[model samples]
Target: MMPAEQAGAAALLRHLAGAEPIETHVSAVFVGPDTAFKLKKAVALGFLDFSTLAARERFLRRELEINQPAAPALYRDVVPVTRAPDGRLALGGEREVVDWVLRMAPVPPEDFLDAVAARGGLDGSVLDAIADAAFALHAALPPVPGLDAPAELGRVLAGNRQAALAAGLPPARVAALAAAAEATLARLAPLLAARAAAGRVRRCHGDLHLGNLCLLEGRVTPFDALEFDEALATIDTGYDLAFLLMDLDHRVGRAAANRVLNRYVARSGDAGLTAALPVWLSMRALIRAHVLSRAKGPGSGLPYLARAEAMLAPPPPRLVAVGGLQGTGKSRLARGLAPGIGAAPGALVLRSDEIRKRQAGCAPEQRLPAAAYTPEASMAVFRELTDLAAEALHGGHAVIADAAFLRPEERAAIEAARGGAPFTGFWLEAPPEVLRARVAARRGDASDADVAVLAAAAARDPGPITWQRVDAATDPLPAVRNALGLNPDDPC
Candidate 1:
């Protein structure tokens, strides 16, 4: 197309979308009041070859097809930008197509998760919405057939390293990043293969960072699936989710990021991902770092490099135990505390309630028989918690043990898991009436402890508690900070 024709097409797109055209490194996005038009740039990179018009159209179709399920209502169709005998540009014209554009319903610009973070709108409820949407899609998407996730992830890491080197990053920094990635890959190879064979690899929304997510109809919806590469899109579900988790940690505060991960795990029952996150999350950050380097150069990618390092090799692990009577908000404090404790996505929360349910072969909300909570069963639960905590600590992840450790002996077992790491033990307390009311009002909790259980717990001798006692009526975050010697204002 000639310069005048290109200019005409630009004007047409702006007119059609009722807004100015916004250009990305790979595409032009024109956002209108109600609709958006995406125009692919006539440029080719090694990973993507879209310099030709035909190539652009093919990718346009791919984008439309793949992204439709991600945000069905948002991705309307692909509209062609064509020229007429009058040498004027028109949208969806019958003449030979000059260019192609992906048309989508426009989500609120300010409601993009990134923008929400900027405006301080990423609250717990917002994060819950985001987690719900992401997990729903994960469960909804079909599994990839015969995928070898370890090999695929290895290739992605190599590509990221190459891109970093090509972007003129300092050789030492690139090499260090590559080395960390290689080490993590080696540790995760067998686990990655197992997850893939178990059908945890799926066709997912590949570009799931906050920018591509927006609040539509009051729910967080992910858009812009990876149309450039199917291999990149079909990935381990946990790894696929790592991008959003890393993005949240990088752009928003660590607390929001942690909240999202914990909530998603609880809702999705994908606790298996907790251990692999150190590797997957680091890979996600490094991939972002290289992608940013390709667009804005190495200088602009340093922050992401630092984030990658933190994810790859976080500060040494620590053990935090949140225990108290049934209604003392121990679980609540544990979940909130997990995000800011160690590295990205925070900690491995080994909840006694969750473990017990697993032992009994029941769902979190299912009622267990009297035998399920027998002394033997309780001992087994505590033992599993200790083992899980030790495993997480050994794997270089922080641990949060959430349980009603009314007995000092039970608490001691958890404390034993703190090998080289610092340990913080907290016992939440409240009035008997408060505990009764809280347990009575509980809904959708993994714990089956009710008013009767709380009454029984209150009557039992706690046996010389060594953990710090904190008020359950007030915010536990202050107590957590105090225990960790962090400043009151520290968002971590």
Candidate 2:
């Protein structure tokens, strides 16, 4: 299409939408009452080129193809903006093709994850759903068998360094980031190769931020996947997920980010990915910093640059175990303390209940049969919990083990799982009536412990509780935070 035809198409899109388009560097989206149209700009960047009508149409079609499966209700057909004999423009006319457009159903602006987060609406349920959506997308994508994971990440690091320098960011900091990232990548190359061989490298949603997510049909759906560049999208799933984690850490809080991370790892059973998390998170932060520096100014991105540096040098990993009877609020205390534990997204909370549910091939909220909770099965769950805790600790990430720890042997095993990391244990206690009432009022939780189960647990003497005892009749977060030396007001 000629410049005049492109101009005509743009005008027609604006007119049809009855508003100005939401413009980006590579595309413009005009959202109407019921319909939305996205048009690719006729520009060519090094990574992606949509300089011709054919290229634009191909990319638009590809976008539809890539996004349709995950968000079927949001992505519609690709249509062409056409001009008639009278030189009037229409969406799909038989006269002459002006430019191609990706048509979509308009989702409410307030429903987007970014908007929801801005209003402090990212509660536990919403955060879990977002992680679930990401997990489903990653699981559905086919592995890119021959892709070189380390080499691909190396390019990302190199490109980010060049871009940061070009954008006039502080030269020293940029250099430091690049150097640290290079060394980290070199260290992780072997692990990356092994993960790739295990089918952990796949085509994923390259740009997975809060803005690209929305609620579709009461379900969190991800849309507008990176479609112009195949190489950029084909990456390790952990790196792909790191984008969302970093975004959440920056935009929301580390607590939200940590919750999503734990949920994803629990669902995917990919705990080894934590080894590369810091660097992946740093890369994500550096990219955002450079983009912001180029768009706004150097000062706007300095914080992100600092964050990029911090993510590379996280605090030493630690293990904290919270143990109690059924209703002592162990899960609640773990959730509250995880954000303050260690690292950017905080500690991984490995709950025995969730692990048990996973072992039984059931959802976290599903109730397991009585047969599934035999002593042998329960011990197996504890063993798996200790294994996972050790894995996360070895990867230089903090962990909080949430379980009854009713057996003295189980306590010994968890304490021994910390290896060289510092370990802390909290044993919670509440009145029997409080425990019974809390268990009775529960709904949609991973724990299957009921009043009868609580009674049975009380019947057994848990031997000696060596860990610090805390009252659980009220909130225990403040006491736990105090014990861990975490500021109550800040979640770093």
The lDDT per prediction is: 0.80, 0.91
- TM-scores for all candidates? 0.84, 0.96
**Per-residue C-alpha lDDT of model 1 across residues 1-492, encoded as one tens digit per residue:** 323435666778878788877777678788988888888877776788878888889999998887787678888988788788887778886997888888888876787888989888898778878887888889888878798787888898888888778876677977887888888788878878888888899988888888988887777888888888888899988887888888888888788888778666655656667667877887787777777777887788788877777777766779999888998988888876776677667876788887888678665567787778899999998888888788677667788899988887888888998888899898888878888888999987888888888888889999987888898876777767677775555455
Model 2, span 276-339: residue lDDT tens: 9999999999999998998898888889999999999988999999999999999999988998
| Model 2 misplaced stretches (Cα beyond 4 Å) | 1-5, 488-492
| Number of colliding residue pairs in each model | 0, 0
Predicted structure with the largest TM-score when compared to the true one:
2
